[model samples]
Target: MIYKAEKFGEKYTTRWDNIDVDEILSSERLLGNYKKCLMDQGPCTPDGKELKKNLPDALKNDCSKCSEKQKINMHKVIDFFKDNKTEWWAELQKKYDPEGIYLKNHIANNRHGDKNDDKRDDDKKKEERDEMEKNDNKENSR
Candidate 1:
């Protein structure tokens, strides 16, 4: 498992692209371990550590450095988390997208053919706006 970035050129190495993403998605234990590793709540395996290191750049750049297979696998993992593990997904979002900079792109790209996802995202945006407005009102009154 050559996880080092040194060998990477224009795009990341494809060494780990063949990982069984569906197995991880479907296995509670594997999913939890990955979540913990990603969130720094538990120790990371070598591959997990590599993923953690690369995740921020991947999210920020919309996986621009990913190979096509990597992109598909990444989308599958992300969509699974978003749909099945909301709490873990929110934690990841808070860490990776604290300011919500990449959130719209994420939602737009990972809709997974679900129309209700758009409505969910819109409702989430409205709630966030409402919270921000309330905070502003409180600050202004001070």
Candidate 2:
């Protein structure tokens, strides 16, 4: 699947099968920091150029700042995934359920081995959310 970036939202989606799980997981971790870039500072593209140019001050705010750390950390994480795709993919497959087929699939596919329990719990939450959305649609249609 192609990962498309949203206009205003920072979220993107790619095919689960096509994605290198380890890379995706790494990217997910980095995305949290990217989110910090947006929330604390302002919008930024993952491409790094924008963050480098527009938000230099925000980027250099402080090491103690999660956003600052995220900015720097994301670069290393992204670089590692790009350079070590095969190794990362292997690790991801070994640790995660690629054929998730559930709500938790979204989060689970991106987390390390120890987080499966949390993934299961997240799946439950997603199921509930889905059910609520369905019910809401039904009510609206009535």
Which candidate should be chosen as best, given lDDT against the real structure?
Answer: 1
Give the number of the best model, judged by TM-score: 1
Candidate 2 Cα misplacement greater than 4 A, ranges? 1-113
The C-alpha lDDT values of all candidates are 0.78, 0.41
Model 2 compared with the native: what TM-score?
Answer: 0.22
Put down candidate 1 lDDT per residue, 1-142, tens digits, no spaces. Answer: 1232436456778888788888878899988888899898999988988888888888788877788888888777767777788898899989987887666676677656245586778999999999999999999999
Clashes per model (N, Cα, C within 3 A):
0, 1
Cα RMSD for candidates in order: 8.5, 18.1
Clashing pairs in 1: none
On residues 43-102, what C-alpha lDDT tens digit does candidate 2 reach at each position?
555443344333323223321222333433433443444345545534433333244232
